[model samples]
Target: MNLEPMAGFLTFWAWWVAALVLAAVETVAPGAFMLWLGIAAGLTGFVTLATGLGWEGQLAVFAILAIVSVLWGRKWAKRHQGSGPSSVSRRADQLPGRAVVLVEPILHGTGRAELDDTVWLVTGPDAPAGTVMRIVRTEGATLIVEHIG
Candidate 1:
């Protein structure tokens, strides 16, 4: 008898489902792309409720929402996020600046040294055992070195 409003409601439901599913996917992936898509869908549904746009206009609105969300998200990430050091890597970095003694002399730019009874895997500048070395840098669980000679 009368299905136009019912159809509109169904379209609204479609938008809601799409938004929810995309949001859930975003939660699992944690990259923000799908999250933005979900926001777009939800916004499109909201606009549809207020404006009751035709199907083509609804699609256009969805596209605009997605594009804006992604662009905004990118800007937000750049400002608020960083390639800052993680806890473990920062600890390893702290090691290199410390003092260590050459328990094994560096020969040909490779050797072992001791720092607080833990042997430091070292590199750079040959130095005899009993000589002191300083951490120049770190290389993957190994400490690069500079010989005091």
Candidate 2:
């Protein structure tokens, strides 16, 4: 068998090069989807080098790996996906469900509050300074404060 050509890939090096390039692009892209193809390509490269496979077999491996990788990634994400600000990697964790005192006295208008020495943009009805307020919700870095009246 002529080892110089494996389908469109010229020897195993072609697949190797393609896999490497895809892996690098995956880093720049930073997603599980592309990583799958990169891995599959790398695997195909090694397989090409290790064994003599026809184009049909190579294509079969590629398709199987792609489908499996994507499905695995999706399931992994689904199992790990979370709800609320707890999963969020930010300071938003310190705001939700916390008690705050009206520093500027919100009276039927917007105002701000400080919790744990952190200032948060708030929206609520009229209230005076020193009134106890609770953070009901958070919206895009803003806190939805409600007067505990």
Candidate 3:
């Protein structure tokens, strides 16, 4: 109920302490949300130390900084969204142009081929078992191949 004592206890250093707490929270449960708030608090501490702003002004500055940092972070994330390394989990995408030996004879434009530890359904011209084929493309779970020799 009494605010005078609490208001006297809040200093510029209190903002810096709040920033550190927010940063620790960000590390434990991260999605960049608390990170921006921490940054805002850190900047507010610096501004408070330099300008000696009242509590009202400090709150205003922190609110503005938090909004700006979050919006900027979102825009930055969107711009870099497609610039990461290509996914290696899609085994089919990496199969094209690679050669594989047919494990089952192709009788009607379909057969099975072994590559690595997996057997893949293949579709192409008729080929005997043990014949080598190069993957040209993929159709769903099937590999489309062409004769290698």
Q: Give the best candidate by lDDT.
A: 3
Candidate 2 per-residue lDDT, tens place, 1-149, comes to 97455544564677778778887888888556777787787788778767767677887887888788778877877778743345446666556778987777785668878877777677888787777899988888778888675
Per-residue alpha-carbon lDDT of candidate 3 for residues 16-36, written as tens digits (9 for 90 to 100): 899999999999986778888
Kindly list the per-residue Cα lDDT of model 1 for residues 1-149, writing each as its tens digit.
Answer: 99877776778878999999999998789678998899999999888877777799999999999999999988887778755756665788677567788888888988888887788778878778888888888888688877553
Please give the RMSD of candidate 3 to the true structure.
Answer: 4.3
List where candidate 3 sits over 4 angstroms from the true fold: 1-10, 78-86
Q: Which of 1 and 2 is the better model by TM-score? A: 1
Q: Candidate 2: where is the Cα deviation over 4 Å?
A: 1-10, 80-94, 108-111, 116-127, 138-149
TM-score head-to-head 1 vs 3, winner: 3
- Candidate with the greatest TM-score versus the true structure: 3
lDDT of 2 at 75: 82
